[model samples]
Target: MSIEEKVTSIIVDQLGVEKDKVKPEASFVDDLGADSMDVVELVMAFEDNFSVQIPDQEENNIRTVQDAIDFIKENQKA
Candidate 1:
């Protein structure tokens, strides 16, 4: 799968949400009903699955599925 597809799948699995609900613009907290802990776990899942280190400071900007995908696309080791 592509990075965007992988990121969306991860969010769906991590948050237990429907695939249709994991749109790129959807917010993890506001749109997907994820709390702080869920967000943290999601970040960890992305890091582990993509083999990328997402710094704490960057977490704030990764509220949307697209943001996480972009960040991983930019930083993940190929």
Candidate 2:
């Protein structure tokens, strides 16, 4: 699957939402109904999926699905 699909699934599963609801323009807090804890779990999921450790400070920068995907793409090992 594509990165977008994979990221979408992660968000959907983590937040217990519908896949169709996770759009690129959707905000995690406003549109996706993600709370602070959901955001934490999403970061953990992304770290696990990418096998990369995202520091606490850096986690704050990841507010959207695109942010997660970009982080993984940049940090994921070869």
Reference-based lDDT, residue 36, model 1: 100
- Give the runs in model 1 whose Cα sits over 4 Å from its true position: none
> How many steric overlaps are in each model, in order?
0, 0
After superposing candidate 2 on the true structure, give the runs of residues whose Cα lies further than 4 Å from its correct spot. none
Residue-level lDDT of model 2, residues 1-78, one tens digit each, is: 877888888898889998888877777888888889888888889888868899999888887777778888888887
Q: Which one is best on TM-score?
A: 1
lDDT of candidates 1 onward, in order: 0.93, 0.84
Q: For each candidate, give its TM-score against the true structure.
A: 0.96, 0.87
Candidate 1 has which clashing residue pairs, if any?
A: none
lDDT tens digits, residues 11-34, model 1? Answer: 888999999999989999999999
Give the Cα-based TM-score of candidate 2 against the true structure: 0.87
| Candidate that would win on lDDT | 1
Model 1, poorest ten-residue lDDT window?
3-12
